[model samples]
Target: MDENCDYIFKGYTPNFTLQEDDIRAIQALYGGKPSKSFSSPLSNSIETYQAVSKQMAPSVKSSNKNSALCLDPQFDAIITIDDDTYIFKGI
Candidate 1:
């Protein structure tokens, strides 16, 4: 057997938004605080944020295919919408 074959492969799908429990589980496994920085440029602009949210809102409400957590830099807030409920947190 090749030495590299000793490593186990794990597959993950991309572009999937993590839920609160998912985030907590990852943190518990990693044993660290989550990063404070936003990963997407969409977080820096309100118009873009609103636009994306508008696009994602229907899909999120209608199905489990897409979910989003967006940051509003101007207000220093993180927003997540699930079905009919919306959650906002300050960073």
Candidate 2:
């Protein structure tokens, strides 16, 4: 039981392990090979963000759209771009 528990914690069932057929069935259903790494979700988020930012760098640098700035009575300032408005409070 202890050995089986250890196997389960390490990410596989000892008695009911996946065969080649089971792996193929999973790939057919999911459309991609399963990842072998056991990385944390936070690391995955950072990796995804870095990849997206690299792809967006060129377009972001070439953008010429200007934002309009104005002071609000309640907030410190307001920045307007297209139909969106962002307010900065306190400072």
Candidate 3:
């Protein structure tokens, strides 16, 4: 896929917790962390970002079956900033 063609979604939801398992799953398919680098606007409150950074573990359980985040087994996925999701064509 063309790098520039990738879509960008926005927002931040502490509840859309992404964990190591998900990262590992992606790594198994595409190798480490894809091609993207972590580059958020640092100008925001450092404390705010640091707080959110700490929330990636202890995944939000799937028990919330009604959770709005749709999971498509066909494509690899990433939790967008909001607890919503982005399904991608994984390699």
Local accuracy by lDDT, each model:
0.53, 0.56, 0.56
Residue-wise lDDT of candidate 3 within 35-82, one digit each (tens)?
Answer: 777666764666565566556434676667543333322334455657
Name the top TM-score candidate. 2
Model with the higher TM-score, candidate 1 or 2: 2
1-91, model 2: which lDDT tens digit per residue? 6642463223234687677887889989987754685767788787777677556554333333322111122454567779999866553
Locate the minimum summed-lDDT window of 10 residues in model 2. 64-73
Q: Which parts of model 3 have CA positions greater than 4 angstroms off? A: 1-16, 34-91
Model 3 residue 81 CA deviation (Å) reads 24
The pairs that clash in candidate 2 are none
Model 3 TM-score (2 dp): 0.21
What C-alpha lDDT, on a 0 to 100 scale, does residue 15 get in candidate 3? Answer: 72
Ranking by TM-score: 2, 3, 1
Between candidates 1 and 3, which one is better according to lDDT?
3
Model 3 clashing-pair count: 0
